[model samples]
Target: MKEFRMAIINLTSSIDRCHNRLDDLDSRLKKIEQRDLEDQPNISGLVATIDHLKSELNVRDQELLANDVEITGISETKEENPHHIVIAVATKLGLTLEDRNIVSVKRVGTTRGYIEGELRPRPRPLVLRLVRRSQRDDLLRAARVRRHLSTVDMGLPGDTTRFYLNERLTYSNRQLFFKTREASARLKWKFSWTRDGKIFVRREHGAASHRIRNEADLQKIFGINEVGAKE
Candidate 1:
C-alpha cells in the first residue's frame, strides 16, 4: 500500500557498521579469553545485545520487502482536456526514430496527438508496474514481485488501461518512458503512461501495436524496436 526506495550506500554502511560491531565484540571476547574465566568481564549482556540487534536487522529486511512496490518515472500531470499528441512515422522507409531524416523532431509547441477528458486519479497497468520495479527496484527484490497487467474497471471496455495518476505534462519535458521486452535488451520500445503509471495503449491492427516491456517480447511480438524495425 505504501512505497519506499533503498539507498545502497546507507544499507551497505549499516552492514559495515554491523561488521564494526562484530569487530568490537571479537576484541572484547579476546580480552575475556586472556583473563581467567572467574575474573573475566561481563560478556553475557554483550552477546545478548548483539543477537538482538541481528534480529532487528532481519525485521528491517522483511519490512523493506513488503513495501517494495514501484512505478517508472512518469512526469505528466493530469489536467482538463488531456489529449495526447500522436506522431506519424513512415514504417516502410527503413527509417528509425534515431535516423533523424525519417521522423520529424517534435517541434517546439507543436501538437501531433491528443487525449481528451478531465483529470482524475486512476490505476496503472500491471505491466508498467513490473517494468518500473525492474528498473528502480534498486534492492533487486522486484524481480520476484509479481504484478497483473490490467486497467481499472470503469465499465468502459474502450479504455483498455487506467492508472493512479492521469495527469499530463507539456510535450517536451519527460514525454517518453522506455520499456524492453527482452530479458536482456536487444531492442528498446518507447511508451507513455498515465500519472498513475498505467501505459496507454489501445490495441491496434498488428500484434506489434501492443506495449512491450522487454526486448525479447518485442522481438517475439513484432521483431523490431523502432517503428521501422517492425515494418
Candidate 2:
C-alpha cells in the first residue's frame, strides 16, 4: 500500500508538471498572436506611406521625361553624332525639323567592345529631347503612322537594321511597363501601351483602360495578389 501510494503521488506530480508546461506554452502563443495583431496596423501604415511616396516619385519622373522620346536600332557610326542622326530620322519620317527645336540627343548605352571574330554589336537606342511637348507628340504620331522606319530609310541601304520610337520613360516606369506587357499577354488582354511615360492596359476592345502606375495598380487590374511582384 505504501509503494502504491508513492506511485500515485509521483503520477499526480507528473500530471501537474505537464499541465504547467502546457499553460506556459499557451501563454507564449497568446502573446505572440497579440503582438502580431498589434503590429498589423503599423505594417499597413508603413506600406501605405511607401506607396504614396512611390506615386509621387513616378509623377516626378514623368514630368522629367515629358519632352523626350527613345529611338532604337540606329547603327552606331564611327563618327557618331546623335544630333545628325536625329535630323536623318526626322527627314526619313518627312517631318521638317530645325536645330533649335532639339534640346539634346544622346545614345543610351556604353560603347561596344571590340571582338575580332564576333559579329558587330548592335547599336544602343537614342534618347532625343525636344524643346516643346508638341514637337515630341507630332514626332511620335508620325512615326506610328509610318511604322517601318529603318536604317535603310535613313541612308544605310546596304544595312537591314530596323528602328522604333517610343516615349522616354524613367527606369522604374520602364520596368513596370515591361512587366505590365508580359502580364497583359499572359492574361490575353487586348492592349498594352505607354503614353507620356505612363502604362495603360485595356482588357478588351471598347473596355475601360486601366493605368498601371505601380505593382498594386497592376495587382488590382489583374485581380491577383502581387502579379509581377519581382519587379
lDDT of 1 by residue, 102-221 (tens): 122121232223435734333221111122223223222222232332333323233444222112222211222233322113333343332222223323334234443323443555
Q: What is the lDDT of residue 207 in candidate 2?
A: 98
lDDT of 2 by residue, 70-114 (tens): 998777776777787888888888898788999999987788675
Clashes per candidate (backbone, < 3 Å): 33, 0
**Candidate 1 lDDT (Cα, whole model)?**
0.34
After superposition, candidate 2 runs with Cα above 4 Å error: 1-36, 111-118, 156-158, 225-231
Best prediction by TM-score = 2
Superposed by TM-score, candidate 1 places the C-alpha of residue 14 at a distance from the truth, in angstroms, of 57
RMSD of each: 24.6, 5.3
Model 2 gets an lDDT of 0.85
10, model 2: CA deviation in Å? 21
